[model samples]
Structure formats: C-alpha cells, structure tokens
Target: MSPARAATSVVDVVAAALRERILDGDLPPGERLVEGALAADHDVARHTVRAALRVLAAERLVVVEPHRGARVAALEAGDVTALYELRTALEVEAAHLALSRHEGRLPPAVHEAAASLAARCRVGDPRWVRVSEAHTDLHAAIVRASGARRIIEAHGALAQETRLFLLRIRPHLGYARLASEHEELVADLERVGPRALRAHLRASAAVLVDQLA
Candidate 1:
C-alpha cells in the first residue's frame, strides 16, 4: 500500500477502537482522553491517536479542547429525546418501505435474523454487548430492506447516538421486554402490512423516549 493508504489504515484502526470505547462506556461521558495513553493502548503513534480523536470530535463523540485535551461527549435529556425522535421517524419509515417492497413474504436472511431475535429473547442474555448487537442488527435489517439511501443514513446516525445512551442504560435494562418486542415486531411484519409495522415501530420508539424521561 502507498504511504497515504498506510496512514489512512492506521487512522481507521485508531478511530474504530476509540469509537468502540466511547460507545461501550469504557470512555464515559466527560472522561478525559490522554493522547499518549491512548496511543500506547492502541499501539499507534500520538499523531495517529490525535488524528483519530479529531474524527470523533467532529462526530460529536468527543469534545476536543485546544492545548488541553479531549473528553467524551455527554448526552443530556434533550439529546436523548432528539435521538429517539430521529430513530422513530427513520425506523418507522424504513419498516413501511421495506414491507411495501417485500413482494409476498419476508426475505430469508431477514426472516432468520428476526427468528434469532425471538430466540435471543427466550434465552435472556445478561450481557449488554450481546444484547446490543442483536438490537443493532434487527434495526439494520429493517432499514436495509427498504433500499432507501437517505433513510438508511438517518437510521445509521440515530444508531450511533443510541449506542451512547445504551452504554449507560443497558446494564440496568436487561434483555427481556426488548426480546418480546422483537418477537412482536416480527409477528406484526408477518401478519399486518407496513402500516401496522410502522405503528409498532413508533410505539417501540416511544418506549425508548420514556426510558430517557
């Protein structure tokens, strides 16, 4: 690879690690980020670490201070509400569009993923990370099925924001109602049309908003 390609790869690696820590709450909101420490942890140079932090700062994941340092971004009550609002609109839209696009039945992978979600609920996982992956994939499947470009982008942004709040909430929330909700969503998609799915999605979003409240 060229010099530029190598540099980009290093930056991407640093960025991904930092992003994971941020979303996972290892780097909690208002936590200071020591550049040299992060560089050592990631096995990258300080310059590379700085470059990665800058990208996250631009994403509002971190607050960068010149001559000071960077810290994790905090999500306030209003921020939570805004995130859920966006999630509600885009996810409901995606569900509606995807159901409309489905000619007769759900696609195989989607059906399987939905079934897996049901199974996950029955088992009752205590691990937040495991719960999150299932939640993320289910939403991704719904949005991807729509084949809508801008809607997918919007959903992606909301998912990122949701991850931050989940960092704080997941340990306490557990994986019960969420699992049943997934089963219900799958059943709704199977029985009713997009309209009912949209209603279900909206109600689901409302639950998250209430959680924030």
Candidate 2:
C-alpha cells in the first residue's frame, strides 16, 4: 500500500480497537482519551492516535472540543430519541419488505442471527457490546432479506450507532428479557406477522427511552 494508505489502515485498526474498548465499557462515557497514552499503548505515533480519534469523532462515537482533546461521547435523551426514531422506521420497513419479498419465510441469515441472539441471551449478564452486535446483526439480516440494497447500506451505519447507544442503556435490558424477545420475534415472524414484529421493536425502543430518561 502507498504511504498514505498504510497510515489510513493503521488508523482504522487503532480506531477499531479503541471503539471496541469504548463499547465494551472499558472506557466509559466522558472518559478523557489521552493521545499520548494511547500512542504508547498502541505503539503508534501521537499523530496516528489523533487520526484514529478523528475517525471516531466522525462516527459520533467520540467527541472532541477545542484544547480539551477527545472523550467517549456522552449521550443525551434527545440523542437516544432521534436514533431510535430513525432506526425504528428503517427496521419496521425492512421487516415488512423482507416478508413481502420472501413470502413470509425469513431468510437463512435472519434465522442464524435469531439463533445467535437467543444463545447469547441465555448467558448470564452477557456483555453489552456482544448483545448490541447480535441484535444489530439480527436486524441487518432482516434488511438484507428485503433485497433493497440502499436500505441495507443505510441500516449498516444505523446498526453501528444502535450498538453504541445500546452500550449506554444496557442496564435497562436484561439478558433473559433479550433472549425471550428474540425468541418471540422469530416466532411472530413465522406465525403471527410483521405487525407483531413492529410492535416488538416499538416496545423495545420504548424501554430504552424510558431507561435513558
């Protein structure tokens, strides 16, 4: 790779590591991200660390202010509301489209995602980051089944943002409840219908909003 491209690649790698740490709660919200410390820990130059932080800032996973450096982004009630509102709209439509496209039979990916999530739910106090990823994968499968390429692409970014927010509000969601909900969602898609799935999404969103409040 070219010199510039190599630097970009390193930044991506460092940023992903930091992102996982943030989502896994190793670095809690509002924790200051020291560039020099990160550089030493990651064995990269300070400039590379700065670049990585900038990439995270673009994703809204980190916040940077003049002279203050970067920190894990602190979420507000409004942020939660906006993210869920848009997420709900996209996911509800994806469910409907997937059903319409597949004639009520879910795609294989959807089933796999559901099974993975169900298993994770059975684990006691499963990590918030893993739960968030499994949940997003389940929804992404639904969107992929819709065969709407653009919607699938859009939902990918939403899925990441959803995971970020979920990390913050995971205290409100129980492992048992998450497992049961996924189980119910899979059953509803098979037997009941899209309306049931939509209701489930809205209800889940409401719980998150309440927790944030």
Candidate 3:
C-alpha cells in the first residue's frame, strides 16, 4: 500500500517477466535490455527498470556493464566448466548421502521425477525448455533425497544457471538421450553410488563445454 512497497512490488513483477523471457529463450543471450525502452514498454519508471535489471544481474541471468547497459548473459565455455565442477561436487556428495541415509535405496521421489522426465521426452515434439525443466527437476529430486539441508540449498542455488546451460546444450545432446541417460543414472545409482552421478555430471559438462567452443 505504501509508495515504497508498491514500487518494490512493481520491480519484482518486471524482473520476473524479464527473467522468464530470458530463461525461455525468448530473449536470447547478448540481446540488449535497454532500461528506457523497457520502462516505456512496461509502463514503469526508469529507476524501477534499473532496479529490476539489478535483480536479474544478481541471478547471473543478465550482465550490466558501464555504458553498454544490460544484456542477457552470454554462455561462456569457462562458466560452463566451472558450473559443472561445482555441480559434480555437490551432486556426487548428495548422492552418497542419499544412498547412505536410505539404506541404499533411493527415495520414491527420485523415481517419480525420472518418470516425469521420461514422459515429457516421449511427447511427439517436446519443447526443449520443458524438457530442460523436467531434467532439472529430476536432478533436484536427487539432491533432495540426500536430506542434507545445506546440500539441498547449495544445489538449489545452481538451478537457474543449470537450466540455462542445459537449454543451450539440449540441441546437441538430443531430447531422447537426455531422458535415457538420466533414467539410466537413477537406475545405477544404488549399485554404483556417487560414481554414477559424478560420471554423469562430468560427461554433461564436457559436452556443453565442447559445444560452447
């Protein structure tokens, strides 16, 4: 109701709209996001647009540079490698914890997530973004199975970046392969433990980095 609160709410709405556009590939990487144009389009003040850009920048979805203004963040090979390195560390550990905690059986949620992803892939023509979302959900489910709050929180932080990276690489990886590989990983996790997950992450990182190159 207050003026300040109202302004903050507008900023959130604007930022969320922009975020969805970027993540959905409607606003491709390197596309400039001019504050003046966005302000006019969204019917908000320039300062509000500026604040919305800041929110996206914090998520690494936008790059705000001096004079050049803001643009959708470009995917770099180095960033891909770095993200996967962190993912390997967090996810592999999560897999270990999950297997140990559940007496070598994965939680039912993991199977459910995998099934959901497989079903999505079975569609006649799957939207890459939807497939990517399902892929992310399956991995998040694996992390959740760990029941380690800190591990879950850490992996959750990477979700957006992971989705972005996956989107870029999905074409190269193929929808069917993505679904099959994850299903295989989940099936083998109990027998092989974290090794399966580490291998999966490392392989994906290699593919993405190669594509970016």
Question: Which candidate has the highest lDDT of all?
Answer: 3
Local lDDT at 196 for model 1:
60
List where candidate 3 sits over 4 angstroms from the true fold: 1-5
Q: Quote the lDDT for 143 in model 3.
A: 96
Q: Flag clash pairs in model 1.
A: none
| True-vs-predicted CA distance for residue 191, candidate 2, Å | 3.2
* lDDT score for residue 61 of model 2: 89
lDDT accuracy of residue 195 in candidate 2 = 77
TM-score of model 3 relative to the true fold? 0.91
TM-score of each: 0.80, 0.90, 0.91
Residue 22, model 3: lDDT of: 82
Candidate 3 or 1, higher lDDT: 3
The per-model lDDT (C-alpha) reads 0.73, 0.82, 0.89
lDDT of 2 at 72: 93
**Candidate 1: where is the Cα deviation over 4 Å?**
103-105, 116-127, 192-213
Clashes per model (N, Cα, C within 3 A): 0, 0, 0
Query: How far off is model 3, as Cα RMSD?
Result: 1.8
Comparison by TM-score, 1 against 2, better one: 2
Q: List model 3 lDDT by residue over 14-73, tens digit each.
A: 998898788778999999999999999999999999999999888788999998899999
